[model samples]
Target chain A: DAGVTQSPTHLIKTRGQHVTLRCSPISGHKSVSWYQQVLGQGPQFIFQYYEKEERGRGNFPDRFSARQFPNYSSELNVNALLLGDSALYLCASSLRLGGSSYNEQFFGPGTRLTVL
Target chain B: LAKTTQPISMDSYEGQEVNITCSHNNIATNDYITWYQQFPSQGPRFIIQGYKTKVTNEVASLFIPADRKSSTLSLPRVSLSDTAVYYCLVGEPLPNSGGYQKVTFGTGTKLQVIP
Candidate 1:
């Protein structure tokens, strides 16, 4: 089975520009989450969507947002990109939301965003 | 979310066993400990998760003591491919905590498996 997949494998944007990254979850998965990984650090949670509803959010700024689609796909939007926004954006999918062991999330290769 | 603390890095050789420990002194009752491994440019891959005691899988073993204040991830006979960053995450999902449950990952332990 195909794992979670992300689009626009690499992107370059300038300050003040907006960018949207896409992700398609593994078939039958119903939850998607986003994270940002800067160089030499662990991924930081951004947002999580389950069953087409916003289930959770992280300490990200208001400029970051995400939503899950009917097909279980998700989109992460970052507005007014800052130099600090230049990091790898990751998308992960789980069979469902919550603490079930079966709900383990599988992540994608991620989209490398470079803010110029 | 329970904050975790792990070594910044570790070194091991082929055919050697490597154990990385994480401390979460303030872990909540509902929080479960999960570990993830990540290669360069790729997202983290789930390694193993455990609530308490010992949990073993084909890849590694997770050992949690009764106190639940700390856990250890043991990799047996690690190879060069096992060189990656290992993260320890602690949290529960769902309607609790303002319905915004999320895992906060700290700087992971970078394991370098030398040939």
Candidate 2:
């Protein structure tokens, strides 16, 4: 089975522009989560969706939003982007929403976003 | 949420064992200790996880004391390929409302293995 998959492996956008990144979770997985990793730093959680419902949110601003679809795919959108928004956006998938099985999040290669 | 603290970096030679310790003084009862390995330009890969005592897997071992304030990840037989950043995260297994564990990652410990 494939691991989590992300789209637009790399992206470049101007400040104040909008960007949307996509993710397809592993087959049979029902939970998708988004994270941002700045250079030389570990990833920070953005949002998480389970069964098409928002379950958790990070410290990100209102400009950042994400949603999951019926098939368990997810999209992360960032509006009014700033240079500080440039980072690697990662998508992780788990089998379900709770317990130890869900704690081990399998991540995708990530979409590298560059806001200039 | 529990906050994690780890060393900024570590240096080791091939064929040696490496132990990276993480401190989570504020961890809660429902939180679990997890370790992840990340290479440059790549997403993190799960290494090991444990709530207490010791848990060993093919890739690494997780050691947790009774107090649960700290945990250690031990990598055996280091190699140049093992050079990467290791992250320790503490969070509940259940999602809050957004469907995730509300995880917070620290700066991580960068391990460099010499040949």
Candidate 3:
């Protein structure tokens, strides 16, 4: 089966502009999560959606938002972008939202956003 | 969330066993320990995970002692292809279990495998 897939591998936008990144999760997966990774740093969680509902959100600002579709695909949107927002946005998929077992998270190649 | 601390970098020769240890002094009873490997310009790949004791997969082994304050990831006969950043994450897998559960990654250990 195909793994998680993301769109627009590279993006360049001016400051204060808006951008949207898309992701399609693996088949049969129901949870999709978004993460941001800056250069030389580990990824930071942004938002997590399970079964088309927002399950958890990170410490990001209101400018960042995300929604999950019924098919388990997700889109991350950032408005009024800042130079600090320039980073690799990663999408991860899991089986469910809550449980004791820690299922492995499958990740996408990510969309590199460059804010000029 | 438990804060994890790991070595910043490590060097190993080909066909050598590599072990990376992470210290999480305040890990909760329900938190799970997970390890991820990330190559440059790519997303992180889950290597292995364990709650306590020992768990082994085809690729690596995770050894968590009874104290649960620390964990070790063991890679046997590693090669140059194994060079990557290894992250140790300590968090509860459940959503909204305690306020909001977010996975916090440390600086990670950058493993350089020389051929």
Residue A20, model 1, lDDT: 95
What TM-score between 0 and 1 does chain B of candidate 2 receive? 0.93
Q: Give candidate 3's error at residue B40 in angstroms.
A: 0.7
- What TM-score number comes out for model 3? 0.96
The candidates score, on chain A by TM-score, as follows 0.96, 0.96, 0.98
What is candidate 2's lDDT per residue for B33-114, written digit by digit as tens? Answer: 8899999999999888888999999999999999999999999999999999999998764634433667678999999999
State the weakest 10-residue window (summed lDDT) of model 1 chain B.
B92-101
DockQ of each: 0.60, 0.60, 0.58
True C-alpha contacts between chains kept, each model in order: 0.66, 0.65, 0.55
Candidate 2, residue A65: Cα displacement in angstroms equals 0.9
Model 2 lDDT, full chain set: 0.91
Candidate 3, A57-76: lDDT as tens digits: 88899999999987889999
Write down the worst ten-residue block by lDDT for model 2 chain B: B92-101
- What stretches of model 3 exceed 4 Å from their correct place? B93-101
lDDT per residue as tens, model 2, A1-116: 78899999999999999999999999999989999999999999999898998988888999999998999999999999999999999999987777644267899999999999
Collision pairs in model 2: A55-B97, A55-B98, A55-B99, A56-B97, A56-B98, A56-B99
